[model samples]
Target: MQIQDLPYPDPGVPDVRSGSRFLWWLGRNQLGGQIRSMAWGLLHFTAVSAQPFCVGYAVQAVVDRSGTRLALAGGLMALCCVGIAVGDTFLHRAAVTNWITAAARVQQLLARKATQLGSALTRRVAAGEVVAVSTGDVEKIGWFVEAVSRFTAAALTVVLVCVGLVVYQPALGLVVAVGLPVLALAALPLLPRATRRADLQRQKAGRATELASDTVAGLRVLRGIGGEDLFLDRYRRASQDVRHAAVRSARMWSLISAIQVLLPGLLLIAVVWYGVQLAREGRISVGELVTVYSSVMVLTYPLRHFEEIAMAYSFSRPSARRAAGVLSLERSTDTEGSRPADVPSGDLYDPDTGLFAPVGRLTAVVCGDPDAAGRLAERLGGHPAEAGTTSVLLGGVPLDELPLDAARAAVLVQDKDPVLLSGTLRELLDVPASGDVEPRAALAAAQCEDVLEALVQGSLDAEDPLDARITERGRSLSGGQRQRLALARSLITDPEVLVLDEPTSAVDSHTEARIAEGVSRLRTGRTTVVFTSSPLLLDRADRVVLVHEGEVAAVGEHRELVLTEPRYRAVVTRETQDEPASATGPETPSEAAPITAAGTAGATEADDDGAFRGALEEIEETA
Candidate 1:
């Protein structure tokens, strides 16, 4: 299949053709450019091939003892020199174009594959590996693609020169042509060993890259724990390992290169020696002998490409394999018009824990295990739910069973550290459901007034409210600010089911309390599952389901559970009882709050009875 037919668009795939055949594929891709380069190669060969003829003519002129003819040969030699120089100039130029265009095609393919894999990319491959592929491997792959064209032209030049030598002086031509195969074949035996060495060198290099990436990502934490020296030592070791591997690889190549140079020079000497003998025997004229010597010498260049191409192929083979591994990762394609099954109307079910947030209720899940909560969110969003351990059911349909896109549209999981793509603040809140929530309300609910104040012009310039400049991943903001912004983003989507994992963890108590009120006020009559230990957020929910040992161990109102379940109270209150001192240990902003129990035990029949009241009130208030 063509590269286009691969699971994703990476043009570097091997096709029905092996080396040359695959090259032909690229040639076919940019036939016009290849034609131009070929023409240049031909011009180069013509100019170079004429020199030998000119030399042979000059010798013949000397043998005939004709001064004028010899002078004429001298002039022809000068013209051939000019032609050779000019041809080589343009030949190199055209060859560069061939290389660039081929690399461009492969780059496009890799980019497309990267987009297709999306989030699953990191799960399937190391982040550093991807970084290296995009930066380093892309160029290496491109180098191979372009090398194909030069090798092709060089091969053709060698063939044409050898044929001309044979026809010009049959015996000498046979020597030059037969000797051509020997120089070309000399590098063959070294290829396998060279390739194995190269693969090891590249692997070692990747390990080094991975080490650097890991160290940089955790530089802050590493320093905090006094582990910087340890990580630094590991990095040094990895870098040294890479250097050693590279040296070993280079040693093998240098040996092959030494052979490539030595054998070709020896071959040239042998051909010249044979030609000189043939000339003495009267089988060839003086001019024919010179032509034989020049042709063999020039053919040396193209023959070298034969070995160089072999080496380049060896180095790039590993890169190709890595790129292919990335492309080979299977991606789930969401079919059209599919909705999640098993979700009974609007209920959310965590199949892993057998926990159900009854239809249209505000259920708060407090999982002691953070990982379980995160996985539960992924399951709820219908991402590839892990077999046996992670799965959520909506109605009768298993989340993973539904199409990925359809399930995602129905259920949105806002990760605590969700990335804020670069754009305006308005753009941040304008999520996929097309910013269904009003900007003011979402910003207020997430207690993002400070965030909005920080943004330029409050994103009012665009007709859309969500347009605000957010640096890559919202790096301009603090952890808490970015978290609240991400929360606002999720709230604006207003999916049928909203799964939030520790959304308020980074915010202050006041902001968290406000967020609790804003969200509980906003998402009434919809299914919401929040995983948090914050009493403020827990109190706001209709019911708090305590997840212990990977399963739901307790379910009740925050107050009832806080007073009864010691573990539940310990988790939410972070203590067994309130302080006896009116210091009540620093009276919490949570104390006087109703639903102050879970922080929003505020989930009452009367509260949700006015489910749409918040949306209506916001519309009236904003107006």
Candidate 2:
């Protein structure tokens, strides 16, 4: 396949049985490219091999002073040179095409698998490993694939040269024949040690890459905790380790390279010395001795290819194994048993936890463990990736049974740490419109006006809110700003069910309260399942269900639950039972506000909830 026609319609299932098998599979897939490369390579090497005979004949003709023989030899030399030029040029072209196309195909498959796994990908494999596989590993695999055909042609040339030398002059030919194999085999004994060192180098490099990625991603957090130097020092040590490992690997390969060169140089000297002795004894013609000598020298070029092929296979084997490991990951959800293609219409329910979200109602789930809540939210969205787990059903039908596209379209889950792709704000929000909800309306409901203003402040060119660019993962924005922007994006989707896990965790009480009220108002007739422990958010829910010890502990309105259930009150307040519960209700913002980590430890929900409600009220009044 050509580079431009890459990303095959179906990248096809890879043979992940083993690394060698995967390499073989890649070669089998590109048979035509390999054949073309080999054909041109054969012609190129054949021309190189034929040159010695022509030069030997020319030297004999010059000694005999025969005009016709000299002219004939000159013509033959010119023809061989032309053949060499043609073969060498086209051989390079074919080899490069094979390399690039093979790498492109592997990259496409990796990208497709990454998209299929989604959030589960990082959980299964390290992000740095994935990066390495897609970038450096792919090149190694392609290099091996491209080298195979050249290796074959080179081996063929070596064999043919040995036969011609034996026929032309037996003594010199035997010397060449015996010496070539030894020269090629000389490096084999050291290859095992070299490969081990190379593998160690690759491992250290991957660890360092992962560390660098994590450190850069959490730079803000590290600086906040005054631990930036600590991480930097750790990364420095990792980088040094990688460098040391690379140097060791290079040392082994250098030894092999030295052996390869030294052996061939010794072989060339032997061939010339034997041929000169035979000529002195008159056992062979001067032309025959010269021919054997030239042929032996020509064999060196093809012998080097043996070393190259060995190196390529050693490096690419591990790389292929890594790629295969990634491709072998299956979706946790079983997409079996034929089912309808349309989205099932009804309430969404997770059979595992027995959590039912009624249609057209706002249900709030309060889980003390954030990780558990995230997993539950993922289940509710029809991607129960945990093994041995049942599916989340909608309208009495399993969500996994529905076509993947339809299922995704029906339920939109906004992760706690949602990534905002780098693009203009307008492009970011220009997702598939699921309903009549306008983007601006979703933004207002999310209380992201400050985010828009921040973008303008960050960039002078961002006079237009839609024109503002969001940096990767919205890193340029504050945590709250990123959270609000993500919420707005989800709101704009307007799916049948919106599963939000800690949607307002980063925002303050006032903004969270406004968001809660806006969401309740906006999604009045839609199923909305929110996982949060904030009092402002829970108070606005139609029903609040508290999850404790991995099971539902209580179900009621936020006010009634707090008054009746101590566990529920403690979870929301983040306080011990020894602390007295305030008697104030949801409308009393001072007694019901959500506490921020930066806020006073003694500050009660009663103190902040009232302030949040009053601020919301004043804003509504002003509008």
Candidate 3:
């Protein structure tokens, strides 16, 4: 099957698997492969069953001393060998196809889910869990799925062999028939405990993966703060915990394995001892005894398969559940009222927080905390939020009430440090369509003429930097450069409501000035919301709303805010840049940016020179 055909997440299909139902669904997707594999497996198993019968028949012929009959028996054994070779080859071939297709289907589901959830996915799910699910979890699911059919075939072969033995030699048949069930049931009691251990181990492993991913993603920030060693130590501790869990899981499975071997060994002994006694009593002939013994030995192989299938189930069920849990994450919920596409874009209101952003104007949101700004942006975009997941109204209708596609189509929330995909500059710009913005017009709008010159001089874009090759995540570009490119992309989209979060945070003053100017002009006559403490972006906005304590504290233009709002000034200028004085996690309280202070633009230096930034910190703290 083609990789795309796998029932995975995509633009059209959001990933939404609930449990093993997903894995089973994958098998259903490749019904043709499954049917073919099952057919081959049945034939293979039938051939396997015949091998034991052939041995018993050959033994009887040899004992009779019928030379011609003996030759025919030998020929039959050779034919059985041929069947084993052919059947085994085709069985393995079909089995591998099944395994690959199952995994591909799982991968597709995850990919599609990632798309459906959009930015919300990263917020709720850990990066590491996502990684593990796509890479490791998919295969584990596939392993169990492919193993199921083989196990089915092996089980059927075991049943047929036993039934044949009972009919050929009634006394031996009864012992063999009863022995098979005992072997199959041997692992049943241990299965539950083993499954529990496996689940714990899998959950721990996912968490460990998340920790490692978090550490790596934050390595740069951690190094800046001299917290690398601390994070490293934390990672090492997590790794050790995962190792311990894995060891516990392995121990349980190992115990199960030992039991499988022991039970089968006992069964073999019982069958052999019974057959020998039957021969002594003249209840079964020597040839009959050899055939029964061979058949029982063959049965051992399938019995071992039954044990393996149980173990695979115990191990993979936990991983499956984890994958299902991710798929089952509640997506953004829409409210009852539907917003009209042509509602004449006006004030956007948030019902939960009682916050409102008036339409057809440049509105700057000044949140004491940048995170607050980001969350509000989420609400503005009609993104699914918690009970208070910012329910902003557009034209009297809540943003959440609009259909996702229509809302997204109307309002674009350009996040802080929006991800830049690998491609040429133009390729990046026209993400939605084969779009090409007139180079000069776009560069002037983004104030990226300087960037364009660099791109062209360096021969980055023989076509233009706008058309130049941008590496994955645009790593080849500077931090500020990537940010501008993202802004440019957003500008090109030209949506009605453009919500930008700290858009100019990374750029220098000159570039920031140009972008601020370009943004105002490009978005003229449309609704534009810029979330920033930068006076440049703030000064340009038609109105500014300062949020303190999760509610709007003040509303006015930049100059009005500076004079009227003290906390707003502290945040706008470098006046009060106090952020925890040290490190704190998401749970810790953080000081919001205070009132607008007089200063142009520069990157945050509060972390490096606390004493120099002390007064600035005090102003924000006082507020």
Candidate 4:
């Protein structure tokens, strides 16, 4: 594909069997571009090679004192100059096109793979590695792809020039032809060391990049915990390691370059010395001596392409391997036999936990362990801990059996710390939806009016809140603001089944209550499963399931479970008291009378609110 038609509709499935294989696959896919570049390269090098011949003929003509031959030689020299100009221009254009298109294709493939894997991509590969592969690595790979064609043309030109010299003047021709191979092979011994050094530098650089990424992502937390210095020191050491590795790599490559220059200079000296001896003996004319020396000089130019191609391959091999590693990652739901499964009309069931959210109902799941709750939420959305082991069934069909798109469309899961991508507010909310809920409505439901106002206030041009630009990862916004915006985006999708884990954890109690009611109102008929222990959200749920030790312990209304199930109360309210509570029998007046007593229930709720606020404060501090 052309660079202008970039972002290929399909980047084509890459053959990620190995790094070298991946590079080969990329080359094969862009064969047409390679051929075009090679054709132009051939023309350019051939034209350059002809210049030496033209100069040799001109010198001979001048020595012969023949006016007619001199005029013909001058004309050929001018024509060679024109050919050089035209060939060089088009050759550069074609080479650049190949480089840009190759890089673009690789970028598209990485993006597609990232989109396909979603959160799991980071889990399988380091965030820094992904960044490195998509950025610097892409350029390196393109460099190698473009270098191959030029190297081919240069090699061919050298061979052709040597053969021409052999036919024209065998005495000097044999000297150049034999010396050229020696010069080319002189750097071969150093290449292995150079390649190893480069690979080591790449590894160190990747680690340093990952460290820097982690440090920046948690900079605020590091500052809060007074650990900034510790991380900074760690990063400094990593940077030093990378620097040392880079220096070593550079040293080896520099030595190879020295060898290339030294050997070629020696070859030129030998050719000139031998041609001068022949000239003195009257075995070769002054014109032939000049021609041999000039040809050897010109041949040195193409000889450097040999070292260049080797260096390019050394740097790009590791990059290709890293890119291949990322593309090779598969999501838990990815399977060769996966097929489209219709949206289920029945409950979303987690067979592993015996937990199910009935169709068209808001179900609240309460688990003592937040980690367990998060895993359950992911499983409900068809992303189990392991591939081929998930038993989450929708309408009696395994969720993992469905195609990724179908499963994602059928169930939308928003994790506790959902990320808000950088973009205009309008663009952030512009997602695949059923057209049932408007962006404004979703924002209002998620209590994001204050967030929009903040965006407007922070904007330099006082643009509309929807038009304001968000920094990467919504880092410019507060935690609660980011959380609310993420919720709004998820709400706009209006998927068949929406699973949220602590959707309002970052917000205060009042905002949480409003969000709970708003979410309930907006998702009236759709099925939504909320995993939370917040009383505000649990009270709003039509059904609450209490999960203890990874299994459903109780299923009842929030208040009913709070009074009847001690385990549920302990888990939700963080209550330490182990007082026995009636399970099968109705509540006695002593237990139920407090609810009817004036201001008594309010006092109890105030206590619960205080406890909840304390818990939130602790979570925020820990974060």
- Model 4 pairs whose backbones collide: none
Best by TM-score: 4
Which runs in model 1 stand beyond 4 Å of their true positions?
A: 1-51, 54-120, 331-345, 358-361, 389-391, 395-398, 420-431, 438-444, 447-477, 492-494, 521-527, 573-623
Ranking by TM-score: 4, 2, 3, 1
Worst 10 residues of 4 by lDDT: 593-602
Q: Model 3: per-residue lDDT, tens digit, 1-623?
A: 64345543431232346556655665566677766666677677777677767777777787887778777877887887787788788778877877887777667667656765667888888778888888888788878877787888887777777788788888888988897898788879988988888788788888888888777656667878999999889888888988998898788888878887887778778878888888889888988888877777777666777877887777667667767777777566642336555433777777665666667788888887888779888778877776635457777766666766677776789899688887667778775521444545655788777676666666633764566676767655667887887888888777768899999888887678778888888778878888998776777888888888887888887766665565786777556534323233334334333222323223234422333244344433432
**For residue 175, what is the lDDT in candidate 2?**
85
Worst 10 residues of 2 by lDDT: 593-602
Off by over 4 Å in 4: 332-342, 384-388, 575-623
**lDDT per residue, candidate 2, 23-55, as tens digits?**
999999999999999999999999999999999
TM-score of each: 0.74, 0.90, 0.80, 0.90
Task: Return the candidate ranking by lDDT, descending.
Answer: 4, 2, 3, 1
lDDT of 1 by residue, 430-518 (tens): 55764557868777888887876666553445444355577766766777888888887788888888889899888887778788889
Worst lDDT run of 10 residues, candidate 3, spans 594-603
* RMSD of every prediction: 8.4, 4.9, 7.5, 6.3
Candidates 1 and 2, the one with greater lDDT: 2
| Tens-place lDDT digits, model 4, residues 453-557 | 989988887477889878888988878999999999999999999999999988998888889989999999889999999887888899999999988999998
lDDT of each candidate versus the true structure: 0.71, 0.84, 0.73, 0.84
- Which model, 2 or 3, shows the larger lDDT? 2
lDDT score, candidate 4, position 140 = 97
